[model samples]
Target: MRNLEIRQFPCLSDNYGFLVHDSESGETAAIDTPDADAYLKAASEAGWTITQIWNTHHHFDHAGGNAALKAATGATVYAPIYDRHRITDVDHWVADGDRVTLGVHVANVIHTPGHTLGHVVYHFAADRVAFVGDTLFALGCGRLFEGSPGDMWQSLSRLRAWPDDTVIYCAHEYTQANAAFARSVDPDNPALADYAREVGEKRAIGLPTVPTSIGKEKAANPFLRPDDPTLAQSIGLEGSGPVDVFAEVRARKDRF
Candidate 1:
């Protein structure tokens, strides 16, 4: 199978916009439209017309460019069904277990609520790639805006089950700060310390800190490691359930 060529660039100061293209078929799709002009310029320069948009949530920074991008490229917009009323100009409403296509590549849609009730991720399993939006980040996860910690933990658990090799593509440049918080909680983690240094080096070189693998996240992502005995003990939540551990971690992150 030919790999999908992914183009990622910073948008709106912190958010990232991605364009995934099937090299064999020339079909391309934008993961989210943070800025239409940036997406347009990038896609045009790459010589691929965006035929589709897969929006993960209803946040303005994530879907704000939908109208303009669709008007410019006539792309079909697909958004999570749960928040269809809030997200505008959606041509298709997708629910969990739905599949979206980028040429011959198919992405399984996983509903991940926490940051937003309608948030979803597109996991192209065969290709080992996932556009996780804001649900799962480099060293952390999104805040609880419309869902509970349990809801988000269940969502993360689902993501945690994905193939360890799957490369996670998140939507922000917040790894440096997230790494700092992860260190504070997972202080004894040698892997996290090393990963934090790597993240710092990448940022110093103006490199993106995303496309982290599931295995890498499993090791260094504090949000995904709530059950770790060391983490639980360090946070003074020893013997707590995974959900409560997650809740505490999230609360600390909020204050961090």
Candidate 2:
């Protein structure tokens, strides 16, 4: 039996550090570490030794604590080779199609460059999990920092091809804000309204709005549903191609 546990460490307001653990083998890995102390504290509490660190991008908020955690736990750091120099102590530089093993489980690296030139998402097929750093989010995609809008659009499109049941572990807690934007784009979407209400209630009670399934995101996330006519019409680019619609929606959200 394969068991997956996702623990979110809230860092830098909305940034989240995700811990993935396989209880069967007592093996654990972390996706992006913004706060070393929080990661260590969580590991201690969970009684799982950190064995690996997967970096989706080289952004400071995502890879900031890599050096400290590596030194403390001696965990093998896996990162994309494009920005090897920027990330410290990358024991293994992975590319798209590369498969990494964690105990009996395996994660396939999908080089999704947009949020950064070398951003990568780790997909555990058996576990139906994907650790998508900044490239993709719960309800919104990352800002175009290192790549063009086209690059981000393509990256998100590839992610959308995954099984709808796949669970998305994004790098931030931006659901509430993103859902707000989604509601504005499609006010008639009861799905978005209901999701916003549920998220608001979760936040009100100090709960984490993460581990969202791809199906839910496709139905609720305006960024991922560019083909929807309501979103397309809202952006004044109705009947446009999917990519064009995505660009318009992204640009609008950038200002929103």
Candidate 3:
């Protein structure tokens, strides 16, 4: 069995640093770290050495702990080639369609630029896992900071093409609030209503609602399923394409 373990470290309030371990080879990787101490402690407890750091974007909050973690573990850092200067100390600069290996698992690097010009997502095909940072979230998406709505829309479209079973690991724990916004836009969606209740219960108990599957998000995440006529109509964007509908939903949520 391909052992894939995802440990969520709640750092800087709602931010989450993920530690992915492949037990078959005992190799571990971290995705968009915000706090080094939390990752270090988790690594120690799990008896796994962080062999690589995969960065999705160049945000300070996401890459803040990269240097420190590299110094502590001597792990190789991988990032997009477009923003090489911003990532600082990137050992391997990857681009679209590049493949990187960790132990027995191989991850395909997809150039998902939207949140940033060089943002990327790592897809571990064997494990059906994808680490999407800032581009696609549980219910909402990252604000369009460096790229246009079209750019983010295309990026999300690429992610949507992945197998529905692919487990999505986002970099932040924004499900509760995002779910609320999702309900507003898709108030009649049974899946959205159910998901909101589930997420609320999890947050109230201090549980992390992460590692959500692509299939689940497709059914309930308004940002991903903007093609739904009811959602588009509710936002006053009737017959809009996915990108336009996504922009409308994002704008409304930004104000919400």
Candidate 4:
């Protein structure tokens, strides 16, 4: 099987849009439609037709462009089953373990209800790539908008099971700020420090720090390490359960 081609571009103020293409089938999918014009332009420039739209959640920024994009390209929109009521123009509803395909490339849907109650991520296991939406980020994770800290923690724990080399594509450009917050909590982590510096260098030159890997996030993101004694200690929650530790960390980040 051939590897799918991906295009990443900035949308709105901080959101990132993705286009995944399978050359063999001449099929292309818009990962999420933060902005219709942006995805349209990007697809036009790539000379690929938008054949499918995969939505990760019901958030406006994530699904707002669906109607417009679908109208323009006549593409089918696949959204999470739980949030189908919130998203318009959905042609299919997918739940955890459901598979979506772009030509020969298939992605498994993982229900990750943290940032929103019905949030999901698309994992293309064969390609070792995941479009994580807002559930996970570089050195950070999404806020508990509709779900509790425990809910978000459990959701993130699902992502932790992916292969370490899986490349994660989160939806926003919040790495620089997230790095600063990460350092404040996990101050002595060598991995976090290294990651922070690299993020700084990249942002200094206007480069994106996204497309982070499961390995890098596992090593550096405190949000993903709530079970670690060191992380728990840093938050003054020694011996606390992972849920408590995660809740404390989320609270701190909320205030950060």
Cα-based RMSD of the predictions, in order?
0.8, 1.4, 1.2, 0.6
Clashing pairs in 4: none
lDDT (tens digit, per residue) of candidate 1 on 1-256: 7889999888999998899999888889999889999999999889999999999999999999999999999999999999888888899999999999988899999999999999999999999999999999999899899999999999999999988999999999999999999999998899899999999999999999987998999998989998888889999999999999999999999998
Once fitted onto the true fold, the runs of candidate 4 whose alpha carbons sit more than 4 angstroms away are: none
In model 2, the runs with Cα more than 4 Å from the true position are none
For residues 1-256, write the lDDT of model 2, one tens digit per residue. 7668767777877888788888888788988888888899989988889999999889888888999999999999998888888898789999999998777889999988777888999999888889999888878898877887778878888888889999998988988899888887777888788889999999999898987988888888887888888778876778887778887777788899
**Ranked candidates (lDDT, high to low):** 4, 1, 3, 2
* List of clashing residue pairs for candidate 1: none
What Cα-based lDDT does every candidate model obtain? 0.93, 0.86, 0.87, 0.95
Per-residue CA lDDT of model 3 for 1-256, tens digit only, reads 7668888778887888889898888889988778888899989988899999998889987888899999999999998887888888789999999998888788999998778889999999888999998888888789888888889888988888889999998988989989988988888999888888999999999898987988888889987888788888988888889889988888898899
Point out the higher-scoring one by lDDT: 1 or 4: 4
Candidate 2 lDDT at 48 equals: 84
Candidate 3, poorest ten consecutive residues by summed lDDT: 1-10
Model 3, CA-based lDDT: 0.87
Worst 10 residues of 1 by lDDT: 23-32
Minimum summed lDDT over a 10-residue window in model 2 is located at 1-10
lDDT of 2: 0.86
Estimate candidate 4's RMSD in Å: 0.6
